[model samples]
Target: MQTTQFMITPASGKRLIAKALINYAPVQSALESGTLVIIAGTTNGYLAEEILSSIGQLEDFSREKFFRGIVLPPSQPRTENGRLFDESGFPGDVVIVDGKWKKGLTIFDVADDLVEGDIIFKGANALDVHKKKAAIYIGHPQGGTILASLRAVIGRRVRLIIPVGLEKRVSTDLDEIAMKLNSPGAHGPRLMPVVGEVFTEIEAIFCLTGAKAEMVAAGGVAGAEGSVWLAVSGVKQEVAVAQKLIKSLSREPLFSLPENE
Candidate 1:
């Protein structure tokens, strides 16, 4: 098999992920025939951008900044020195499709009417690679939207798709981490175990390039931090396609919360 390798910046990764989500057969079907609710985090914001741009609706939302759902550090980013979503929630940006109706409904409203084919796109804070599980951080006293969204996901069997990057990988067991983390434990940020269809850069490559991608190396400096170095294995044509697609997404703009909203 022909093998190809390259470095994918975080911004490019997000763009590839957005295209993958849009191309996913299940996501498209649900959006067309059923409900496809998107709970936007930083990464999912890119997915939203792809969806909007696909329909030529990018002008509807502020292209200047991303409307984020729940942001970690949930405080002012040290790098940007500005608060990212001062008061974030799961209602950041939703594409709720309810049969003949389509609108941006609240998480609570989406939760009540969820069904098996419905899709809940939620981002995570960390991923346990060894166990193949992901985790999210919760700060709300009531455990936030994750608590409520679980009911529909676990009870109703709705598809919970998490769009996260490789930069957030964790080494420990997510269950143990969550058990020890609680909002009242007097810690910085509480961890919550989330079970869902984990979609990371690995999945994005396959979805975007139709090639098998493996993480070979990671980490970089000089604006390359949070990048994922991947080794792709496939037919010659597939490898070339992968290369072209990745290069096309290399300059994706970073997702940021609105300066004033």
Candidate 2:
């Protein structure tokens, strides 16, 4: 029951989650013999890099332009879909099959081909950590990638993994929030409550190092904005491993948005 505390910035947390997911059982299984789709988002960008690097196919891949939509500062202009006005440089989603990176492909390109035992990794905009629920914001008239991924996930038993950060956590029930946001009178992006395995920094720490982690507190200034204070506890060896792993990511460079994004 040895416990250790660590401060994890959002950037470092993304790296930690990415490191953990590379060793995830379902991810490993899908990489070797099944379809694994990594939907483009800020968090998934990190996971994509880790997964791609593990298979020696990291070339030509950059997180800079990996996202389809993004949340920018108040001053930054964005479309109704939360995407930058300019999207000419956007790359397609990361779709890996049989351990090879299928360059220039997206879920739509292979959603019909996916079946049971396949896995999809998508990012989330809101998370109900206590209830283990996650949801995404949709500005598309015909739903979005979640709809595409759901055809296989709910209809064909494909596994869906939601990789999100603790910073995105919300205290309200997602369904309730969805009700308000999706209302006819509501303005801006609608919320879609999704069902999947919610993987956060807590889960990431456990997955990678066998240590239990809890978000004890949050917030900071300077480079610590959106940072979380994690209290990790477990066996002596596991806590040691968690400490080392967190240390390795403590200096993960601050993620920067590409020009005009």
Candidate 3:
């Protein structure tokens, strides 16, 4: 795989949007036999949904894959106040709360218990548990929490796949990302200082160049115009997959770095 660094301005990058980015081939390739996938983002769960839609696993894909299964947080159940409990029935051992996994837990803790040989969509902690065992996908957030969590769990050799809309760019570095996560105005009611603490710990970073909305459309679903998406995995494959998806959407080039010379 080719690993190179390129700079993209928020204005130019946002133009592409999540609706225009997403390379399914790389993502599809990653899902061979037993690959755990963890998705992270700030939205309620729209980001995760958009990603699944893109990969042909979504029902609207017309041809669904029986081999794929999704395990979401208990809080996001199908019933009323679903976001307050775990409806997915994730084995208690896999779920992590504060630094502890459930009874049957192993690598991941209670909050980090999302795993699958196929793909698993989850929040930041869950992504941490499966970082090495799976791919990671991230979307728009205040900053730091997901990155920091990656650092705590993923360590130095870990890679990050960040698929973000141009709308979510900051001109600052990881430190800046932390500031936003801590700033009262940055994130809404879900105020938690730990979010900022985790973000600052991220040492490895890679940006996935694509739009979430477009990836959702590729899943053959309609009415996905303004939805969010998430995917958590190593940086190399995720960015590569995103580049491929960007190419499929239009004849125009995916991205062009400004002349530095």
Candidate 4:
């Protein structure tokens, strides 16, 4: 097998990941045929922009300060005296059907019309690479969107697509971690282990390039922290294509957090 090594920066990695999600065969088909629900966060927020805007026109759809789901930890000065500014997900939801973005659709509204074959996209905070499982941070006492979406996704056979980066990979057993954590007495957010189609950068690269990519190394200093290093193995032509894809993403801008976030 042919092997090619790569060093990807964090921000550029997210862009490549976004590109893969937009071009994923199943996702593309689902967007065209079934209802697509996006519970946006920092990572999926980038993807939401990619889905709406064409390549080379990302600037047209990249600003979404209010539409992101983020955790506001109590350690931050923003959280004090039990006042939480946690907006871990957009207050609302976005839906797309027939390859067209539909506005003004709420998750509740989506559930009313949800059916099998439709897709629910949710982001996660942590992934267990060994177990191929993912866990999400929940600020909502009632379990938030994941729980609501699970009803339709699990019960009705709707597809749940989780587009997360390798940056969120965790070494601990997610279930074990969840056991020690509970929303009531937790100093911070509690985690909920989720069952879904977890999409990481490795999967994204394979989906986009048809090449098997492995995480050979990780972490870096001088602004490359949280970035992933991969060893992609494939035929010569496939490796070339993967290289080109990575090149295109090298200049991809870092997704900026909306001011006052």
Top candidate on lDDT is 2
The model with the greater lDDT, 2 or 4, is 2
In terms of lDDT, model 3 sits at 0.30
- Estimate the TM-score of every prediction: 0.86, 0.97, 0.31, 0.86
Judged by whole-model lDDT over C-alpha atoms, candidate 2 comes out at 0.92
RMSD of 4: 3.4
lDDT of 1 by residue, 166-227 (tens): 88887777887777776355675688888888888888888877789888899999878788
Candidate 3 segments exceeding 4 Å error: 1-26, 36-56, 60-153, 156-158, 173-261
> Per-model C-alpha lDDT, please?
0.74, 0.92, 0.30, 0.76
The numbered model that scores best in TM-score is 2
lDDT by residue (105-220, candidate 2, tens digit) is 99999988999989999999999999999999997789989999999998899999999999999998899999999999899999999999999999999998889999999999
lDDT of 2 at 138: 91
lDDT of 4 by residue, 1-261 (tens): 588998787677767787898888777778768888877566777677787774233343434443434444455665444333654533456677767676656566776578888888888889997677899987777887788899898789998888888888889899989987863566777889998998887888888888998888899886676778899999988888999999888776665545675
TM-score of candidate 3 against the unseen true structure: 0.31
Off by over 4 Å in 1: 63-91, 98-104, 183-186, 257-261
TM-score of 4: 0.86
- Taking the tens digit of each residue's C-alpha lDDT, what string does model 3 give over 1-261? 343322322222332333332333433444443332333233212323344455434343111111112233465443232121222333211212222212333223322432321222233222121122222222225432344334433443222334333222223443344455556765432212122111100111222342221111111124332223333233566656654543343342222212320
